[model samples]
Target: MRDSEMTTCAPTLLELQWAVRRDVLGLADGAASEYVVPDGLAPQARLAIYRNTANSTLLTALRLTYPAVQALVGSEFFEGATRRFIGQCPPLSAHLDSYGGSFPDFLAQMPEAASLAYLTDTARLEWVVNQVLHAPDGKPLDLRRLEQLADADIETVRFLPSPAARVLESCFPVDVIWHAVLSRDDSALAGINLDADPVWLYVHRGTSGVAVDRITEEQCRFTAALLAGRPLHDALVDGPDAGTSVWLAHLLASGCFVDVCLSSQASRRATGRQVA
Candidate 1:
């Protein structure tokens, strides 16, 4: 068929499918072979190189983000595990930072990694650390503004947490596992129970790099509620039964909540009048 006639006939669905497969999966076929320039190498060899390069680049990114997890699994084992992971779950975003969010869940199900039961939780902790480091920064809420509200109005005061704050919970002693891998300090690992109930962790950026700390259940619930835009009184109500005053004071001191908003329409109207 003439070139013009072929074009007018409309490209076959098979031709379109091949193009998409080549672009997305880096697949090699007769159509794709036409574009490749073989330099003293077989076409299959060249295509194999492309496959290796693609897998290696993604593996390197996962390694950088989860160095502690890599160390725990050893280089060879980690590479094999990551290869399986990448095959099952290719990156979903252009940003590599968000690439490994599902790695913990992936590790949890891998039978080969079953011996290191804590590995999955460790991966989760590392992912959370990365997320907290990249979270946005914001100013601490003004305590003086909080004081201006009447006792009845206090319950209507909604909280906004700093974008940098993150919470992580794990059944394994993930904090201990993280420190052990990163710091080469085993002291934190002592007395760690892999089967214990999940421990809650909070991470935030302070003056230095990201600071990670264990948090009480009450604090976890309170901060989680606040992060979800809950009002102060409602947050406390949802939190564990403890001293509300002390928990609020600690949250303020930690610079966790960034701002307060009016949860009630009445408060909004009152504040609008004051602004006017």
Candidate 2:
């Protein structure tokens, strides 16, 4: 049979499941309703339960990920906007914490945002924070090994960022906005200059918790390039902005890197105690 013929034919159980998901997310009309046999109550009523649960779970997930966005916008407005977002973007990851990564893009294009020009950037910052909070505890870089290496290896050396590291660049003063919103400091928030120039941030998790720190553009460039798997030499001289040893020192002190390698193969730091 042809492609059209397959759709016209009766769907299997798996196809019905996909159709139900599409309908639940409001991506399709209620065509799946015809397939669901009414059990005690109408099929639509049963499906409504699933919709409510899914929507509620998604709302909670977004609330956790985008707390600043919720605090910036009132609860009523946030819930309304998130509901629309949920309909458009169904959860792809099994983990709720992994959802809502695209919420910043959604906020950027929202027509209702009149005076709140910074909401989108604020959301982007929040998403980075959320990622750092959930990132795995990967092997940290061996600084002793790095320091012991000869000057030649250090030049061509590659470093991998800790799984928890994230860099964000935004036109708005989103770090200040995030701090004000999360801390509930009305004075700090009121004093913000929304039209400030672009800001670069380095986000990471530590013993103290997730830290979002403002950084220079040069630091941002170097850190971002290393995160992109570029060698240290390339990242240092890759752009108009040049990185210094001070920047490298600062990042290393912040525990930004997790692994180092002289060439392509990674050189992991040994951690386990000697076993019997």
Candidate 3:
């Protein structure tokens, strides 16, 4: 073949794949033109199958990640919403399960979803649950080891959520709504007054598997601060209502922190005190 013909025939694999992806995601109109089809072969129809399959896969993944949202909005509405969502926010990574990390934010921006203001928070809850389920396993922080430290040492150290732990705060009753929908308890759903108080949630892997607990606002604040890599002392400053001794005991018992970060000097001090 001539040089020009060779060039025309040999589009890079990446270029073709990107064109197909754009078409599947509805970002472009003429992806099928990238391919040469023989007589009697309908390229548009062939591409449509791939597009439909992509949409179906995305819908299934979304439903799995946000089952509560799907149940709350009903199948038809959820499907329609997801169709739009996938178009606007196509998967950035090949990992399908991690695809909808921004789905809650996307739902928040939708006009139809606005009436159900809690929907976004619900999505957030589901996403967190999904993430916690997949997080790595680790030994929780040892409470006994923590107790040997002095108050000043404790203050200077930072706490980390166990690989299993995730904290989320919502202005809506996200935990209640999630449980009600999943359990198919209509009465429970009915009793949830939308005007009711906001909620703080701690989703983590428990002894029995994944568990979601409703924690206090102070606990949520403290947890958020810790997750942001703040020292325990600084984290406690935001919420005076979070009693230091009480929460320390509760969090330690809850197995929330997988590891504690004590400075090199503090670690030596703690070790020496233990030896003494």
Candidate 4:
């Protein structure tokens, strides 16, 4: 064949076979060819061992991310759930940490988990905890700068929640459910009820470690507004029962708010006013 004809030819059968073998091995399914198998082992058996190892490694990662969910569902049920979850939502990111982001939603729709309505939310909280642990740290807002703002400026300033923070709301009492699963002792079980109304929760990293706190619906809404870049006045317009001063104090005390920004117009006004 001429050089041009040879260059245009398709891959050989051996090349195709090798490609399949590499793919299968990378996915932990072992080589499809018997060439690599041990003398005593069947090709299928050797391949099965690879499949088992791959699944087990994946399952271990999944378990680490969704420990609370695993605890709630028990090991056997969680194993089955993880297998189903993997089949439906294979890892898309190179980082294993990015995997299992959809696991909570998957559990919510699962018939086997229907009875455990809080299971999905618990999983979600666990996921948030993982995110907080891994999120990049940034310097918090300078309280000194905050003190310089006039009362009116405070109304126009937007506050940013910490990078390591996440808010979760669920119809099931997910905070209580998380506590039940994570707490070493269950002594405070008197008023704890799973069927109670939904609750809002905040999970964030602190000086010690990742921590979860139960928060009010109003706090959730206010924080969400701030995070969404709404001005302070606009955020407080629909905030829970308190005057702006009182609400601002409460927010500052929460330790969730970390940064601030003034609207462009407000910043210009402040500069002009100061210059005048």
Highest TM-score model number: 2
Per-residue lDDT of model 2, residues 184-226, tens digit only = 9999999999888899999999889999888988788878988
Candidate 4: list runs displaced more than 4 Å: 1-54, 147-156, 184-191, 243-247, 250-255, 264-276
Question: In model 2, which residue pairs have backbone atoms overlapping below 3 Å?
Answer: none
Query: Candidate 3, which ten residues in sequence have the lowest lDDT sum?
Result: 32-41
Clash pairs (backbone) in predicted model 1: none
lDDT score of residue 59 within candidate 4: 86
By descending TM-score, how would the candidates be arranged?
Answer: 2, 3, 1, 4
Highest lDDT model number: 2
Kindly list the per-residue Cα lDDT of model 1 for residues 1-276, writing each as its tens digit.
356765776457787555534544444354444334577876556666766776788899899889999988899999998888887787765587788889889999999998898898889888888887877778887898787888888878887778778777777778877887788767766666677777888888777889889987777777787777777777777764757678678778878878776787646756899999
Cα TM-score of candidate 3 = 0.83
Q: Is candidate 2 or candidate 3 better by lDDT?
A: 2
lDDT of each: 0.77, 0.84, 0.83, 0.73
Instruction: Choose 1 or 4, whichever is better by lDDT.
Output: 1
RMSD of each: 6.0, 6.7, 6.1, 7.5
Instruction: Candidate 2: list runs displaced more than 4 Å.
Output: 1-13, 34-37, 147-152, 238-243, 266-276
